[model samples]
Target chain A: MENRNGCKLVDLPESTRRKDRFSFTLLVVIIVLIPVLVESKYYLIVLNIIGLNTIVVVGLNLLIGFAGQISLGHAAFFGLGSYFSGILTANYGFPHWPAMVVAMLATGAIAYLIGYPALKLRGHYLVMATLGFGIIINILMGELEQFTGGHDGLIGIPPLSVGGLTFDNDLKNFYLIWAFVFFCMLVARNLLDSRVGRALRAIHGSEVAANSLGVNTSSYKVKVFVLSAMFASVSGSLYAHYITFISPSTYDFYYSIQVVTMVIVGGMGSLWGSLFGAAILSFISEALHVAKQYHIIAYGVFLSLILIFLPEGVLVGIQHFYQSKKLQRLIAVKTPFLLWFNRF
Target chain B: MSNSDSILELVNVSINFGGLQAINRLSFQVESGQIFALIGPNGAGKTTAINMITGIYPPAEGEIYFEGQVLSGKKPYQVTRMGIARTFQNIQVFQNMTVRENVMVGLHTRSRSEFVRCLLHTPMVRKEERMIRRRCNEILEFMGLASKAGLLAAGLPYGDQKKVEIARTLATEPRLLLLDEPAAGLNLQETHEMSHTILMIRETGVTVLLVAHNMDLVMGISDTITVLNYGEKIADGSPAEIQNSDKVVAAYLGREPW
Candidate 1:
């Protein structure tokens, strides 16, 4: 009891805290009810895809958004996860769960190896280094014929299951993928509210300031990079298992760019923004699937508009707009004649 | 010999940036519990010396000893954990973070929990968070920023932002606090409050090393003053002695009494 009392954070009034709690519960309810509300098979597939992107973006948010590290090779880790898991489950006859775990571990190990040296490079140099890594991995995925089937890709990957339930269909797989998505979100939120999150954001703000506050900025950067890679790896494993097919082209440089776009569009430094970014971009991509030739151009236009109009993020933009509207309403009510003059 | 009473000593430290000397063979000692001031003009290298002492820059020559341990090759985080904390010259607050969280971050060194513990948010992590948060609250109240704890640090007014910076540093519970221009953009009343806060901090036995271009604040409260000009120490003495020094006048003062 005494320890609990000592641990009481948030000196806020009870009303504000309760309001926050209500909003959070409402958000959780909405996320849980997403599948129930949407029924089209295509939409279901797209939602699953968005969930996969969300898991990756949430981790990327921790790195690029909070820790201020850019990654242009996130797709490499994603591809690695898919390839590793696919080979283990399909060729080596390993269980789905253990294969996914191994893939995640492999991605984490490789990220640590590459991140230790690569993180020392800053700005465009770091971007170039990561881009090179992605291209190398993409090449290896295509050239490795014996294990990965080269350009033909490995096929007939098994579905993931737990105990007695198998996620064998799009709807079932939707549940599986979203389960992981929410779990990742929970983990991200926990990290964002803790000392580690603060240190990472401090590093983003100013590495010098973070170091002067006793944060090991270099090591933290590497750690977050590895963590984000593991997130990508898990998402990749989910992708390979769901699609039951994966070629090197599935995880290309363009995919990495899309991941970064999702982070930027959703808003940096926010979990909700990551989800929104993934959903909006995935919707846009799928909706324009009929006009495949113009998809890239349309994505370019969308990204440009988002960058130019709401660089802070779509969620933040909406919030700002709402707040201004509320302020306008308050002014109109307080001064009736002023509202008439402001009608123009 | 390294004096047991003095907490920090700089033995002829020097640094050069692209052939331009940023700090030149500067030697100074700060007593264990006194408000020591480092005063200089625009380009006098006071902040550079502080940066070197805090491990942001490695000295090209000489040595910095903190409580008898050499600071050479030590990282900034290492220096911080060794009981030194610093504020920045250009207000490097985490623009996106809240004020309370800013202060809580300073307690990163004091936490003993591993990543697993933090990620899991176990009882131990909770206790640590509570303790750190409570201390942050107390620091904010002391700095007159308790009401602004929930606001984004960048959203605060200039004077309050400076106070938030100091409050965050104080959360480290440093034996030696390095404040870089705590009153740079502050008005007169805020500066008065800041000096009072500095006195209270000294009363609590936390030694201070302040870098400021403002001489009035320096002379009013500083137990000792080191005047710098052209990256070199011009005078080191009591404020009155510094005020009377001819070299300090010709280089730093230029016949101005204020």
Candidate 2:
């Protein structure tokens, strides 16, 4: 993909000389090994939860990582998808596929409602508005005893199946879920490499500069916000169908915090990093089950340390570290090509 | 080019922020393909005028026309789409982005790839991106930044950072480019080099309307000059005529150039 003058994907520094499909290659290898790697259903199911979170993180990465906007109520959108799909299929006798689609559209409308005008103005209003939305949704879920099954939650949601193949078991659900995860990874990767994603990254740098360069900053922001919510909604639908049970607690402020933590820990603005963030956080929280009393403190300490040392997130920090070392070694070896710039 | 062929016009434009008039009844004409310079001291509303022209803020009292279309009340990106591009005074390069990526941002309006095509990574999108990168490299080469195109813009030296800003704006392929203090922090040698680049840019048939405090650079390259004092145009004329204007000398130059 490198041009004759030695430029590749403009934003990618590592694979500039190469085609830069490293993420895709990594994705293919991971998808092929999950069944072989995990023996127990508990681990497989835990991995599935991580897959669902990964989807949310992928969308959030575009909004928060690339566009530099934060949302504190992603879990509310997740809840919308879960409840909308669950109620339609389980209670209303709708087909699973159509229910999912309807749920997605409904969630999209809600996202538009929140993102359009709420995202119009810049700064902390978005944070406050999303926070307010999360709390309000949480309250509504508790109060709508007839629709949501109230605090007790809902059950009997149908499992997803296509062409008579059902994902009723953990192994079946594993492939079903990871397929979406990697598909999302592919889409997210393609997007970041494109002009639309570049515009988002530009806004992240400085919106004033991006605007002068002909970027509609507010439009991009709203679109990313909508896209992020849609991803969360999809994950929610998947969650409801897989478990056939969901409560308001599943989409509370605490869960929203968990999603944001995943983005920050894995690395913002990276698809692979989102997967890592979700997987690592899920594994840590599950592994600390025996140390239940100290789990929250340990998790906080872990995330804080990562943020302290690698403020850009894990993946970017690693890349930066690796590149700096290579640069130091090259500088030590010879003054090299960049030294020629001194003449200017 | 015809002497009276104006590419951009600010017609009695005025704007205020909380009762402080940033620009007041400012009017000027930039003839097509000409190198026009706006010169004044700090707080004389030069940057505010640039902001108004670029659609950062709508003129509260009048209109701005680019190519005979009213530019007032349009979005910033819309104005940019109409062939106007600009650089910020305080070097606003996407610091974390490499020089190539920064220019790619400037090439955004020029890209015609659809969202689905980009999401699928289709050949058309790939081909379009390659074209943009090629054009970006040429701009970098023109700015003498080709050697450092792979480096992060924030990591570059101050003088080189300024060049990168201009390079990014050039990538937009603007019919009319506004440069705000392109040589503000440069040394004498860098200023000379920047003035050379500005002249070369003008030679490419892209009109340049610049705001700079460096009187020497302004007087040397500007085809026409407009002096602003306290949000008002004090004088507008050819560079030779401006260099001799008593009001310009008394207000802006404050001394004889010779």
Candidate 3:
């Protein structure tokens, strides 16, 4: 029972760790190099949109997957960020980068204020509160025409700049957006691997047990809420700058549901799953756009199929398949090795 | 009792649920380095008393002190940080987490590194993490769970899950540990093993307060026993004294001498 460091080392199966590292590195390499290889501006725009959605999904995953909290109004925060940036830059003549920062901080503050009370409600009650918040924000965007430019939305938003270079081209903006997404992913990865992440998992498991272990569950819940909100805000800012036009309809409750569906279909509580979810769902929406009347139906069918076939989500399903194969290989190798040793 | 020596003291504690009085003005003291047992029948308020002690409920009429600090108003997590840890009667292990992860989570209070350090993977945080890992392993080994440390908590057998829960509680490094029905689902062999584990915990000089219905186990290990009937203390004495007391038998049998 007594060890030098005071804990036992339960060795993880080496193949699993190797596969994790390999997949993570492979994802980083592909994301980093994709912009260089793609020549089509349209394709780059799609990639940039995927990056933006990835940021939002990552945040949503923290709330729904790790903390086990339901949020049906997250699109309200996204809409707020967009409108905040759009209003500040369009009317006040503020620079785009500075406006992004201000929007993020404002969204984070709003989330903090709302989360304090919202976290007290659990399950369906929490979902209703979040939905109410979304509806209120959407209605305000519509009613406050002068500030949000009414239903038409603010147009001609100034392009983002870094050190005097404007990110006006799809290629430049693609690089910029993906860089930000990568940073967001890194922050999320670090948070999920830290003490805060562990606490969130414990709360997700059983709040009573978490409390008995001395975890401040309420505070952690609020903190995660704020963090997730900030991620959404950053994504919103990217969308505002990239599209250069945003209507109230873009940030509706339907959009929030789409993001949630992505996370669920990709795999809950997994970082890679968030990214995969965004990519798959975004592709589905684009692929069906030509069949205008059947687009929504096709999207619904895809979501249902994924839910039924892989309830843990696509990423987990794939990971499980790889794991079982690796285990089989290990067993195959071990049997022969054991037989050889028996001869001694 | 003197303030310096007592680890936990309940002063006339009582709990009420509408018309029912679950615990009626109960008073008890647990000193450092002692094993105290609370025994009673099914409806005798044993769990209620434990709930109050662990901050799940505030006493309807009195104060609870831990390490000479008033504990009546604190939250459950606050009480745990103040050096008290407890296990539920029904198993409440973090079912989705790995066995080691569950124990590591319990070690949350012991690590002093800030969130920033953990996120950055700073040298200090890494060093502290290694220390925590070591300590958690020691606790697992103590509970004879070193072999199954990598398995998810829900995948373990019933007795092992109970052991993991105890190990998780032990990782909190509480001065006062309260176990509610630790032997409830355990077989005879497991019950014996648990008795040994309790003795080992006592050997570490931590005060343990157990609520149990197993009369034989209680009588064998407790330095002092408190018997409850209808939320009132019927008797409080050494094992031999409690065994000979007429009130204890009468309370257990639900009758009095003719």
DockQ of each: 0.46, 0.46, 0.53
Q: Write the per-residue lDDT of candidate 1 for residues B1-258, one digit (tens) a residue.
A: 579988999998989999899888899999999999999888999888889998888999999999999997788999999999999889988777788778888888878665556667789888888887767777877776766777888888888878877888888889999999988988899899889999998998999999998887999999999988889888899999988888887885376665
Q: In candidate 1, what are the lDDT values of residues A36-127, reduced to their tens digit?
A: 89888888899899999999999888888988888999999999999999999999999989899999999999999889888776654557
The regions of model 2 sitting more than 4 angstroms off are A1-20, A324-344, B1-4, B253-258
lDDT of 1 at A91: 92
A1-344 per-residue lDDT for model 3 (tens digits): 36554554565433444766686678789877887798787788888888889999999999889989878888988888888899999889998778889999999899888888878765556677778888899988988998898887888788788887988888888878888887777777766666667789999999988988899888888888887888899899888888889888988888889999988988999888999999988987888889899887888888889889989899998879777878789889999999999999
* Fraction of the reference Cα-Cα interface contacts (below 8 Å) that each candidate reproduces: 0.60, 0.71, 0.58
Q: How good is model 2 by TM-score?
A: 0.92
Which digits, one per residue and each the tens of the lDDT, describe model 2 over residues B1-258? 112489998889998899898788998899999999999878889999999888888899988888888899988998888899998899898997888789888899888875568779899898888888778767777777777877888899998988888888888889999999999999999999999999999999999999999998999999899999889999999999988889987885476667
Given the true complex, what DockQ would model 2 score? 0.46
What's the distance in Å from true for residue B248, model 3? 2.1
Best by DockQ: 3
Clashes of each: 0, 0, 5
Candidate 1 stretches greater than 4 Å from native: A1-37, A325-327, A330-344, B253-258
- Candidate 2 per-residue lDDT, tens place, A61-126, comes to 888999999999999989998999998888888998888888888887888888888878877678
Interface RMSD of each: 4.2, 3.5, 2.7
Show model 3 residue runs off by greater than 4 Å: A1-8, A12-21, A322-344, B1-3, B112-124, B256-258
